[model samples]
Target: MYAPRSPPPSPTSRQLAIIRFGLARIVPIDDEAPFAEIAAAAGLGEVHVRRLIRHAISQHVFQEPRPGVATHSAAPRLIAEDADLAAWVRWRADDCWIAAYHACEAVARWPGSEEPNETGFAVANPTSLTMFDFLATQPERASRFAAGMRLYAAHSDLDLQYLVKAWSWGELPKGATVVDVGGSHGEAAIALARAYPSLSFVPADVGGRIRYMIHDFFTEQPVHGADVYLYRACFHDWSHRYAVRMLQALIPALKAGARVILNDVVVPGPEEMSPGLAAGVRTGDLGMMILFNAGDSEMAEWARLFEAASSGFHFKGGKGHRAQGCGFWRQSGRDIVHS
Candidate 1:
């Protein structure tokens, strides 16, 4: 790949502006629509649409074949065609954008705070509740957020298949169980069962058995002595103090030799990856800080978290994987720390 040219002193803002403006909804994918026609369809004045589309062209969102006509480029075309993708863009442009803008103000208001309620998101949105709590009350925004996350997960390193293969689930004996702690919709658990029928899932070979129960991670773990207690993409949402509580809750239920698998992002060291990849990861890391007062951690932090929760947690260490990138921290609950 060729080197990226230095960006102009001021980059274009009209791409995200148009997306926020709902230009995607009115722009035709195949039609090389004229300026006035596009404006009329979008119910906007001709000058505004023309300016937005012209600026969007520079951002590689759309292109103008002639002075007065415009059509979709690859970027906007894909967004227009995919509803989930569009929602993701909108969510980014709206909620995330607001939070990012108010990040400094949030820090100023609640200096060095770890409370989820004391976040940029809370500041920008005027909520006493945290992001998840506030989202629950607003159904439309909640649906958009859910759809955005679905698209984000499917496209990002947090794909479900990665969690399935991050550990050797097949090594466990037949009829061995896996308790997916806070496994939303049991998607990771279901994928694991499908891969290794030895555990429970919809394989039909193991009687297609999968019991999904709602158990709070902050409370005690209900399923005791399972072969694997998996927390995929779960811990990063919480700060260290609370995350420790979640791990501690498992102490009573954890039996000797039971494995605790953490399938989550590990913060990369500087110069460890390409600029683009690192930027995305760093964006997520800071986004966690802004939204939840949480973070993607380093391996040392993971080890420390386990150690903090209980001295009995044997930190088997963690490694980066192609499937999950910097993910999967494995520890064995060889000794229980019962309070």
Candidate 2:
């Protein structure tokens, strides 16, 4: 006799909406409300609410204790308590869901474009504008995206403290200047300043809280010959083509012996990632693919990127942090070794 086999179940938009609806209304209460009440609050039909509730229960998002009464469970309660988690869920349901829905059509149409505007997000919204530009036009979605990033850092343990502890910042000479390229609001610089009082920082970002001149990374870096040019969670947003441009922009400003440190994901090779970390890393890779046609780089890919970016950049090595990854390198006197 052959062993039994069942088809794998795929996720549906209805399932996402069900969870989103549950998150919006279902709270811990004395009495469980019937499906009709939930439907009224959610602006959904009674029969539709009943089916959604049943699906949600199967997914462990909500619970149905009695025949018709729906109540809060552990998962829904957590979403209710954590504002960031709730915002993340909302972003997933509203933004990412739509983007993913339109991804197939985008791929078929654009084929292999690396521009951010060529992404599924653009196709879904029927705009040629990039994500940032589009988000700028829609304040609410932009706010949600910002909140989602902050919350994601909490979820992934990729906070300022991790950067402070992961590197050897104290070893740098006193008064050494560290430029945070593409560092929004200078949070990393602020954290480093606290950890290493002997050093100074320059933040190259718009609307920064610090007292530095605003500069774009795509343009020539204004602060030349800094001790270090730090890129935290920035390079991964671009494809190798644009990433090389960003590095080239910084090359003229890099003095001899200047270090280039990256605080981003170093994607693991096949069968290399631990089971616990595989999901997060792969999801991140997929997210970049959908949004910008970019991706996290593996160790070899990182080295190759530096080589391709400039003949002067040398690939030192890389390692993992709590959840984030690190790549270390410096401007070499000799020509860069091609992979």
TM-score of each: 0.86, 0.85
lDDT tens readout by residue for model 2, 1-339: 998887633344544674567534554544577887778887788888887667778877678888878887776667767766666777787788889888888888889888888988899898999888899999978877888888765554566776777667788888788888887778788888877878888863323423465887899988987888888888788989889998889888888888888887676676866765677667778888788878788778878888888777877775564434522121111122222
Count of backbone collisions in candidate 2:
0
> How accurate locally, in lDDT, is each candidate?
0.75, 0.74
> Highest TM-score: which candidate?
1
Q: Lowest lDDT 10-mer window, candidate 1? A: 328-337
Clashing pairs for predicted structure model 2, backbone only: none
